[model samples]
Target chain A: MQDQPLHEPQFALHVEDLTVTYGAQPALWDIDLDIPPGVMAAVVGPNGSGKSTLLKSVLGLIRPVAGHVRIFGRPIAQGRGRVGYVPQRSAVDWDFPTTVLDVVTMGLYARIGWLRRPGRAHRDQAMAALAELGMQDFADRQISQLSGGQQQRVFIARALVQQADLYLLDEPLAAVDATTERIIMDLLKRLRDQGRTIVVVHHDLTTVRRYFDWMVMLNVRIIGQGPVAQVFTAENLRAAYGGQLALIEGGAVDPADPHP
Target chain B: MTAVLEALGLLFQPGIVQTVVLGAALLGGLAGALGAFAVLRQQSLLGDALSHATLPGVCLGFLVAGSRDLGAILLGAFLAGGLAALSIMLITRATRLKTDAALGIVLSVFFAAGVVLLTVAQGQPGAAQAGLSTFLFGQAAAILRTDLWIMSGVAALAAGTLAALWKEVKLVTFDPDYARALGLPVLLIEGVVTLLIALAIVVGLQLAGVILMVALLIAPAAAARQWVRSLGAMVWLSAGLGAAAGITGALISATGRGLSTGPVVVLVASALVLASMLLAPERGLIWRWGRAARARRGIAGRRVLAAFHGLAEAHDDPAYPTEEGMLTTLIGRPGPGVMERLERDGMIRRVDHPPETTRHWELTERGHDRAKRDQGGRP
Candidate 1:
C-alpha cells in the first residue's frame, strides 16, 4: 500500500475554515481538517463542543456559515452515495412502527429511487448486513422491542447495507452496553482494514488510543489532530478540556511515552 | 324498519344521497391515510390548525371567482392552508414560540380572517352566498356531482402519492435527521406530505366542513393505531375505518329527521376510537387492566404458597396446615377470597380439622414446586 504513487493521496474529508452558528452564538468557529482515507478517526471533545455540529456540517444536514467540506476531494453532493451516516440513537423515534429489516432496507432507498419498492435482492442485502452484525434473528421484530445495544447494532447494520466507502457516526457508543461497544469497535476496525474511512464522534478518552488510529481533539475549534500517539497528548487534552482534565487524565494516558 | 329500508333505497338510487355518500367516503379515506402520518408524527393538532386555516382561503377563492366554483375554491383553500403550515414552521423555527403555540396562533388568526372574509362575501350585492355557510359545518347533503368528481381526483392523488413514496415518507416521519444525512431530499418529502394533508383538508370541506374535518383526519387513524403494529397495516386499516365511519354516519343521518352529516360522521369516528381504546388487544386500556389484575392475583397466590413452605420447613412437617390468619398476615391483606381461589387453582388444600378449629391451608406438592421457582429457590 505504501509503494503506490503519492500525489497528495486524496483525503476522505477536507474542511477549510468551516464555521457554524446557531442564531447569534457560534457553535463552531473557524476549523480546518484533512483526514486521510482508510483511517478510523475519533473526534473527541468536552461537552457543548461542536463535535456533532461538525459531523452535521459534513453531511450537509447543517449549512456552514463560512467555508466548505469536500468528500473524496469532491463536493458532498457529488459523492453522497459513497457516504454512509449513523446518527445518534436519540435522534430517532424508536416507537415508530418499523421492523429491523425495514430500517436496513432504507439504506438502499437512495439507490432504489422513487416509486420503486425494495425487491427480493434488496431484502437479501439487508438480511446479509444484519447477519454481519449478528442481528439476523431480529429482522422481523419491531425496533422498540430491541434493547439499546440491539438498536445500535441495527443502526450499524443500516449503515453497513449502504456499502459506502466512507462512514460517519455520531456518538455510536453513547448509552450502549459493553457488548455493543465491543461489536462496534471490531466492526469499525474491520471496515478500516478493508480500506473504508470511518470517523466517529467519540467521548470515551480511555478507548481513543486503542480503538482509533487518528484523533481530532476539538472544543468549538480544532485543537489538535494527527496520529493518535502524537496528537493525543496531556498538553492537548488540557487545552481542550480546561479544568475538567482530571476526569480524563488519570489511567487514560501513558506517561512513559515521550512527546515531541 | 320502514324508514331504514326507505333510506337504503334512496341511497342506492343515484342522486344527492349517492353523491354525498361518495364524497364523504372519499374524504374520510384520504383523511385517514394522511392522518396516520399526522398521528405518528404527533401532529394531530397541526391538522386541526391547518384545516381551520383553510377557511380564509375558501372565502378568498369564492370572492375571487365570484361563485363557488369547486376547483377555484379548492385551489384557494390549498394556498391558504399551505401558507398557514409555512407560517407555523417559520414561527417555531425562527422564534422562541413552541409548536403548540404557533399552531394555536396561526389557527385562530387564519380562522378569524376567514370568518371576516366570509361575512364580507355574504353581504355582496350580487353574490349568491347561500351555500357558503355549508363549509363551516359541512352539509354533506349539499354535495353536487361536480364536487364528487373533485373529491375522487384528490383521493386518487393522495393514494398514489402514498403508494409511490411510502418508504421515503416513513423514514422522514420517523427520523428526518437521519433521512437528511442519507441525502434523501428530506425537505421535499416533508413538503409533499404537507401538500397531501392540505389536499385532504380541502376536499373534505364540502362534506365535513373545516371545523369538524380534523376529526375525520385524526379519529380513524388513532383508532386503527390501537389494533395494528406496523405502519402498512395501520395505513390500510385507518383508511377502511374512515370509509366505514363515513358511509355508516351518512346512512344513519339520512334515515333521521333533518340531521346534519358532519356531526354524525364525527360521532361514528369517535365511537370507533372509544371501542378501540377499550377493546383492542395489547395496548388497550381494558386488556392492560386485565393483565395487571391477573398479575396481582398470581403474586398473591405465590405469597400464600411461600407462607405454606415456610411453615412446613419450620415444623419439619410437609403436611403442616397453617391457619388463614397466618397466611393473611404474610400477604399483608385479608384478600377476602384468595384462599378459595388458591384452593380452586389446586395450589392449596383445605385440611379438615376438628369442627371448632379455624380453617388451615396446606400446600399441594405442585404448589410447593411453584413457590420454589417463584422465589428463585431462596430459602
Candidate 2:
C-alpha cells in the first residue's frame, strides 16, 4: 500500500516468485527478475519456452498461480496508463471491420475515459503515431487490406499512441520485412533514448546484439538475464534452446566475454 | 395496387396494424445493434441457441401465472435464456466440448422441455394458452397496444446501454486480452454485453418468434458488415437495415391474406443479406469478380507488351517493326485478340502492306519505353 512518485521506481518491471501452469504442465516456473528503466530488453527463448507467457503474466493478461507483478513500483492497475502493450500479430481478427485510424485511436481509450469518444486532439495524436510509423497514407484503409508488415506497423502505431512509459511488445519483428524491422528497431531505440523502457519477445539471436542492450533468456525458467554483452552467450542460448541449437555455434556470444 | 395502397394507408392509422409495425421496428433496431457484437465475435449461433432456449421460460411463465401475461412470459424467457447461457459457459469451461457443441445441446434440450411443458399446459382445462403457440412463429395480428409500450421501453434501454458502453464494448470485442491488460473491467463489460444480448432476444420473441428470432439478430448485422468498414458505421447501418426490414415485412404481411409476420421479416432480412453479399463495394462477390477480371485483362496486356519488348531486344532496335507472323509466334497462339487489345491500348501500331494482306506490328514510343523498363536494359 505504498504510494510513491509516478516517475521514480526501482525497476520498470519487477516479477517475484511467478509460476504459471496450464492445467498439469508448467508454462513458467517461479521466475524472479527486475528490469531496470530505460533499457531495450529482449526476452529471447525457443518455441514453447514461455516467452509470451512471461510477457502476458507481466501485463496481467494471465494470472500466475503464485506471485505478483509490479510496474513502476505499484500494481498494474494503479499505473495502467503508464504501460503500453502490443499483442502478437496473430492475436486479433485482422478481417474485422476497422480502419487503421480507428485501431490507432484505441490506444487512447484508457485516457479518454468511459462514455466519451476520442476528440480531435486524440485523433491528431493517433495520426502523429501513424505518421511516425510511415502509415499515415493508409489511415483510412481497412486493416484487412494491409500486408503483414504494414499490419505490424499499425499495431506498433497503436501502442505508440498510448504514450506510455513502459512498452511490452510480443514478437514485433516476427514475419516483418527488413524495412519494417529497421523501423521498429529505430522506434524502440528512440523510445529508450527518451527514457522509456521497452521489453520485446524476440526470436532472432543474430539481431539481439545490434538491437537490444539487455536480454532475458528463458526455457520455462530463467536461463540468464543481464546486459546483452554478458548473458547473451552461445552457452546460454544452447541452454535455452536445448539440443536444437544448430548453425548458432561460434561467435554468437560477445568476443570480449571470457565465459568460453 | 389497391391492396398495397390500403395496406400503406392502414400502416399510418392508429390501430393494430400500426402498433404491430412500430413494435416490430423497435425489436429490429435493438436486436440489430446488439447482434453486431455477436456477429463480430463469431457467436451468431449463440444468439440462435439463446433465443430457442427461451421457450422453456415462456411455458414456465404460463404455468406459473395461469394466464397469457406478456410481462411474465418475457421475464420467464429472459431467465431461461440467461440460465442457458450460463450452462453453455459451464459445459465449455469444465469439459473438452467446444462452444458449438455446447450451444447445440442446450438449445435443443431446452426447446424440447418447453414443448413438453407447452403440451402439459394445453391439456389442463381453464388455462388461457390459446395464442401461446404464436410465440413459435409470431402472429403480428395478435399484438396489443400494451405490448408496444413494453417493447419501446426495452428498446430504448438496450440502445442507450449500447451507446453508453460503446468504447468498452468495441475494445472487448476486438481484443479481450488487451482490454483486460488495460484494466478496463473486461469481465464486467463482457457480462453486460451478454446480458444485453439476452435482453434483445427476449424482447424480440413476440415479434420474430423464438424459432426464427436469430435471423433478426444476425442477418441485418451481417448485411451491414458487408457494406461498412468500421464498427460504428456497421452498427448504425445494421440498426437502420433491421428497422427497414421490420417495417417492410409488417407492411407486406398486412397486404396479404393469412400471412404471418415473423417468416416474412426473416425473408426480408435474408434478401438484404443476399443483396449485400452480391453488391457491397469491397468485400462483395460481384465486386471481387469484377476486380479479378480487370486484373486478368491487365496481365494479358502486360504479357503482350513484354513479348514486344523481347522481340525488340532480340533485334537490338527500339522501334523494330517485327512481322505480324513473327510477333504471333513469340506471343503464343490465339494472339490476334490480345494484339487487338494491345493496339486499342495504344501500346502497339499496325502497319498493313498494300498488296499483301499480311501486316507488320511495332511498339510505339510509349510502348518502347515500357518495354525497355520491362526488360531492365538486358539487351
Candidate 3:
C-alpha cells in the first residue's frame, strides 16, 4: 500500500446513518461510512444494492429519507469544487453533437462560473487531461463517432479536468475495453498517488483486489468497509450477499446455490 | 409585371413588408430556439401537431369575439395548442401509444376540426370571419405593426428566458439523469423549455400561419444543427437562418403577383434545411462521406506501404519487387486505375512488362515511408 501523508483528522467523505427511499421501497438503509483522505475505495454490490442511489444521496442528487453527508469535515456545498463526478456511459446521449474537447471543457464550467468562457489555460488543462487519458486524437471528433470505450475514456478525461480533491466515478469501467480500463485504473491510481481521494462505484468484484485498495460491500446497506484484508472476509461476504435464510443454512454460501 | 409592381407598391405603401418580415423573423426565431430543445428532445413532431391543434382555438376565438384582432386569436390558439401538448404528454405517459402516433392522432383530429369550423366560419354573417381563413394559410400582408410588436415581444421574452437558463436547459436536454443527479431541477427545466415551445407556436400561428408554423419551428433549427455543435451556437445560427428565410419569403411573397406568403416562407425554409443537411460542416451528409472517403484513401495508402514493408522484409532485394499480380494481391484491387495512378504519381514504378501485359509495381522510398507512417507501422 502507498503511504499518504496525513494532516488533521478529516475524512474525505462522511455519510452518517443515511437512509433513502423510492416511494414505499427503501433504496438505502441506515448506511454509515467514513472514507479517509487519499484512499481509492470501491463500492461493490449487486444490481439492486443502491450503489447509485447512495452516490446520488451523497451528492445531494436525491433527497434522503434521513441523514446527512459531509465532505472533508464540512458540508458538500463548501467543497463543491473539490468533488468531481463521472457518470455512467449509458446515462448520456451518445448522439449529442459536442466534441470530446467540448465535453471535457464542461468540467471547468462550474469552476469558470456562469457566463464566463473558458480560456487558453482551461483548454491546456483539458487537453492535458485528455492526453493523460490518451484521448488527444479524438478531441475534435463528435461524441457519436467515438466507440463506447473511447466515450468512457473521454468522460474520465472530463473528470480529470475538474482538478478535484475527491472524485466520485459511477461505473467508469462499464462498457469499456481492456485498454480503456487500464488507462482509467492508471489515472485513478495516479490521483490516489497525488493524495486525492477517489470513490468508484464498480461492478467487477474479481478485479477489486487488483484495482482498489479499500472496499465497501453494500446491499442496500453497508455490510462492512475497511482495508481489503479486513473487509474481504467470508463472514462479511455472507452478511453482504446472504439473506437471513442463507445465514440459517450455513456460514459459507455456495455460488451455485439459489439462496446465496 | 406592371400589375405586380403596382401590388408591391401597394403592399409596401401599407407598410406590410416591414410588418411581415419583422413578425416572421421574431416569431420564427423564437420558435427556432425553443424548437431546438424540442428537436433535441425528439419532440419536433409534437410542435407540428400543436400548431395544427391551435386552429380550433383560432376558430373558437372568431366565434366568441366576432373580431379578427390578433390578441384574441393568439389567446385561443395558445389554449388549444397547450391542450394538445398536454394531451400528448398524458397519452404518452399513460398508454403504450408512442409520441409520433399521439402527435399524428392529435394533428389529424384537431386539423379536421379546424377545417370544419373554417368551412362553417365561411358561411357566417360577419366580415371578421373572412380573415379567419388567413390563419389557415397566413396572409402576411395583413399583419399590422402592432402584430409585429407582439411577435417581437414574445421572441424577446422567450430568448431571454432561454439565455438565462442556458446551462440548466443544456444539461436537461443532453442528459436528464446527470442533471437530476447533480440536483438540478430537470423537470422544471423541461417545463420551461416546453412552455417556450408552446409560446413560440402560439405566436407563429400569426406569422407563418397554423398550417405552416411547424416548418418555421423545425426547419431553421434543423438547418442550424448541421452547422454547429453547441446549443447556444445552434440557437444563434438558427435565429440568423430564420431571419434570412423570413426576409426571403417576405420579399418573394411581396414581389410575386399571386404567391401566398406562408407556403413561400415554408418552402424557402425547407430549401435552407435541404442545403444545410447536405452541405453543413459537422452533421452534413456530404461532409461525412468526404471524411469517410479520405479515411478509406488513407487506409489504402497504408496497405500500399504494408506491401512495400512486406517486400522490404522479403529480402534485401534492390529488384524492388515487380508483378502487377502480387501488388493486386497485396493491395486488394486498387480501385480501377489506382495502380496506374500510383505509377503516374511516381510513388510506384512499373517495370518489365509489355504495354498491355500485367505490369509489376514497386514503391519508391518516399511512398514506402509515407505508407508506413500513415499506418503507424514500421518504416
DockQ winner: 2
Local distance difference test, per candidate? 0.88, 0.87, 0.78
Name the 10 consecutive residues with the lowest summed lDDT in model 3 chain B.
B177-186
Candidate 2 error regions (>4 Å): A1-9, A247-260, B126-128, B312-329, B332-340, B358-360, B377-379
Q: Write the per-residue lDDT of candidate 2 for residues B51-121, one digit (tens) a residue.
A: 99999899888888878878898999999999999999999978879999999999999999988888887
Q: State the lDDT at A183 in candidate 3.
A: 93
Docking class of 2: medium
Q: Model 3 Cα displacement at B126 (Å)?
A: 3.0
Candidate 3 residues B221-264, lDDT tens each? 88988888667888888888887887778767777777877788
Model 1 ranges with Cα > 4 A deviation: A1-9, A246-260, B126-129, B334-346, B377-379
Q: Could you give me the TM-score of model 2 versus the true structure?
A: 0.93
Q: Going through the candidates in order, what is the number of backbone clashes in each?
A: 0, 0, 1
Compared with the true structure, what per-residue lDDT tens digits does model 3 show for residues A1-260?
11333322389998998999876789999999989999999998877889988888888877898988887866665556678888888877787767888888877766775556679999999999999999899888888889999999888888788788999999999878999889999999999999999999988756777788898989998898998767766677667666643542353433334222
Candidate 3, which segments miss by more than 4 Å at Cα? A1-39, A60-83, A94-102, A108-150, A157-166, A177-183, A186-197, A219-226, A233-260, B1-14, B83-133, B162-168, B179-185, B255-257, B291-333, B350-379
Backbone clashes in model 1, listed as residue pairs: none
* Cα lDDT, model 3, residue B368: 68
Residue A44 shift from truth in candidate 3, angstroms: 1.9
lDDT of 2: 0.87
